[model samples]
Target: MAVALDIVHDTQETYRKVLTSMSRPGTISTVIGDMDNPFPCHYATFLTILTLLDREVYFHVISDGENLSKVITDYTLAQETSIENADFIIVPNGTNEEAVIDAMQKCKVGTLEDPQNSSTWIIEQNMISVTGTITLTGPGIKHTTSLHLDITAELLEMRNRRVQEFPLGIDLIFTDPVSLACIPRTTKVSLDGGVI
Candidate 1:
């Protein structure tokens, strides 16, 4: 039991480092220390699963039986739930805009007192470029920053609608094979016509 506790502690630390890196765009962080599995789970996804997954947290893998989902379940010990009942949703690719939006709509909106119980969406981008002119402002950001996420227009529209709900919406984490970025519910993203 002592060893198990130590692994959990180490995982939590890695998760914290990843979150801090995401909060500050373009910043890089390494997820080191303990790992239960030897699969190719990226540092971002591994840390996310470690920090958020548990018996109480139900997760939905948007991709249809992707290898990433299997690895995630094996490492995190989180139960798979229907889209409507999930506490966390993972999108292995951002191309499925409709499915992603539907999953987001199904997430539960916790009461005003415990709004943090709401779901978190982790979207994997096929490509990430920081050269885009899109401006993001709100919450964790002091000033606007420029970054490009490889998400479809429909997904962006859905996210915009969801963000209009303020503190009652799902937060987002966008990651690639090597890097990751975050867009909390409080963030405001506006794209400039460039390929993102």
Candidate 2:
């Protein structure tokens, strides 16, 4: 028999992992409990969705068919909507960097008074090296920290645009098959070779 996830327990565990990763920013966190088979997207991404999404959330999945979106909405009972309206946006591995930026650009970046409404992105990565390749600083870091990424400069620039105004920026969760890391709006990021 296939292993099953006890919805309440598993979701809570996954939620804790995500929260821990987000709170620590560049640090890696592990997802606890069993995830049977998460297709079209990495298992980590699936579990993150399962943990964070619910009936009140609006989400968008980037793909060619409705299967991925349908499955997510059905399983979570969350509504599926356009990128511009989604509370959570999942960008699968191999998606074009520009497209990811476009979708992110359309997402809600709450106003000064309601910055908490900003969208959160769960982006999948094929690899996350043992040692970080880019540097991260600001809140959550005593000095500086590093983390590996396959993200492009365009995506980095787009992210910067959203964060220009304090308290009104997107939060990102980067996940691979086994690891999860995050970049909250409060962090100041820079790639190797002094690219900020």
Candidate 3:
């Protein structure tokens, strides 16, 4: 096991960086900062899990899982559960459209009265860049922003279907080897080179 990362300070700082990405929607940011990431997934993904998961929650991995569920439990004290009940759904590979959408279909989209009970998805990608054409607008954006994430348009369309209901939706966090970007439920995403 790698013995790096001052849990308290490192986790706090990483949490802030993650929060910044989430709060700002499409803004790209880095996290975990060379803290000896020993997991098979990205440093940002591992560190984000460290920051958000704990004993009270459960997590489930979809593809390229590679025993990460147990590994996460070893670090976060969070247990592994069925996809439908998972608080955090980790997808190390987003190339499988069928499985990705299948999991998303099963994942919780909180009710109108208890919207806070929804799931948070942590998905790994090739990279998170600023040059892509997908437009993002809403809450934290001034006018608009764009990202170049390699996630499938079909998956995004699925997200729109699931989240368009407002309060009841899932939040997305995409990470590369070290960087991450968030797409909160409230953010409007468009791919036709125009606002949705």
> Model-by-model lDDT, in order?
0.67, 0.81, 0.86
Clashing pairs in 2: none
What's the ranking of the predictions by TM-score, best on top? Answer: 3, 2, 1
Estimate the overall C-alpha local distance difference test score of candidate 2: 0.81
Note the clash tally of each candidate.
0, 0, 0
Worst lDDT 10-window in candidate 2? 31-40
Error of 1 at 84 (Å): 1.4
Tell me the spans in candidate 1 whose CA falls farther than 4 Å from its real position. Answer: 1-13, 21-43, 193-196
Candidate 3 lDDT, 102-154, residue by residue in tens: 99988998999999899999999887898997899999999989899887677
Best by lDDT: 3
Q: Which one wins by TM-score: 1 or 2?
A: 2
134 Cα displacement, candidate 3 (Å): 1.1
Model 3 lDDT, residue 49, Cα: 89
**Model 3 — which ten-residue stretch has the worst lDDT?**
30-39
